[model samples]
Target: MKKLTAFIMLIALTGCSKLSMDNYQLLKTGMSYDEVTAIIGKPDSCEEALGTRSCVWGDEQKQIKAAFLAEKAMLFSHQGLK
Candidate 1:
């Protein structure tokens, strides 16, 4: 009942946060991290090394990855994460 309804709502909201191709197409090299996040929602995972950062959005079936250097996007890609 209430718990099941709440769970469904949570899943719906989570699905809405996933990245879309329209937003992904808007990404460009040299865009800032904030700009990229604005297009796609917050990343599901992120990692950084040696002043470079990589962020990913979406689930295992589909995902988008953006790499940043100096706080600006240097590379981007999207595909099935599986």
Candidate 2:
């Protein structure tokens, strides 16, 4: 039964179509990090450790790759200077 359910879910996912900012006018590329952050507020999830910042948004990486999707940008500091 679990296998059957999983198979069904896979089929549904393959058949369905998803949309993102590509279909909307609100987001675009080359915008400043601050501008993107102001519009999106915050990322769904983020990692800020060891002078590295990573953010994840949307179910697929491709979606986040779209314009102005990332809401957070980490400024790395080495020896207390960015």
Candidate 3:
């Protein structure tokens, strides 16, 4: 029944927004900022410091955050995504 469960999940996720755990899982270290955006859509806002750019998608209650150094993803974290 794993296949059935997977199919039901796929159907549930079909038209949902890109800001999801699945897309977050797709993020990898060293991925470019543009590539990350291509998967998660544009970040709500971004900040730069110490030559690192930190971007966040969604809001405080539930968000995905990625830190890019030299425009490549160096770190990423998420909050309250199901």
**lDDT winner among the candidates?**
3
Ranking of all predicted structures according to TM-score, beginning with the best and ending with the worst: 3, 1, 2
- The global C-alpha lDDT for each of the candidates, from Candidate 1 onward, is 0.86, 0.44, 0.92
Worst 10 residues of 3 by lDDT: 12-21
Q: Distance from true position, residue 29, model 1, in Å?
A: 0.6
lDDT of 1 by residue, 1-82 (tens): 9999999999997777446676677899999999988888789999999999999888667999999999999999998632
Candidate 3 per-residue lDDT, tens place, 1-82, comes to 9999999999987768787788899999999998999999899999999999999999988899999999999999999888
Per-residue error at 5 for model 3, in Å? 24
Expressed as tens digits, the lDDT of each residue in 1-82 for candidate 2 is: 9999999999996674332343223445455556545554455666555544455444453334322233333221111111
**lDDT-sorted candidate list, best first:** 3, 1, 2
Of models 2 and 3, which has the larger TM-score? 3
| Candidate 2 segments whose C-alpha is farther than 4 A from its true place | 1-19, 22-33, 65-82
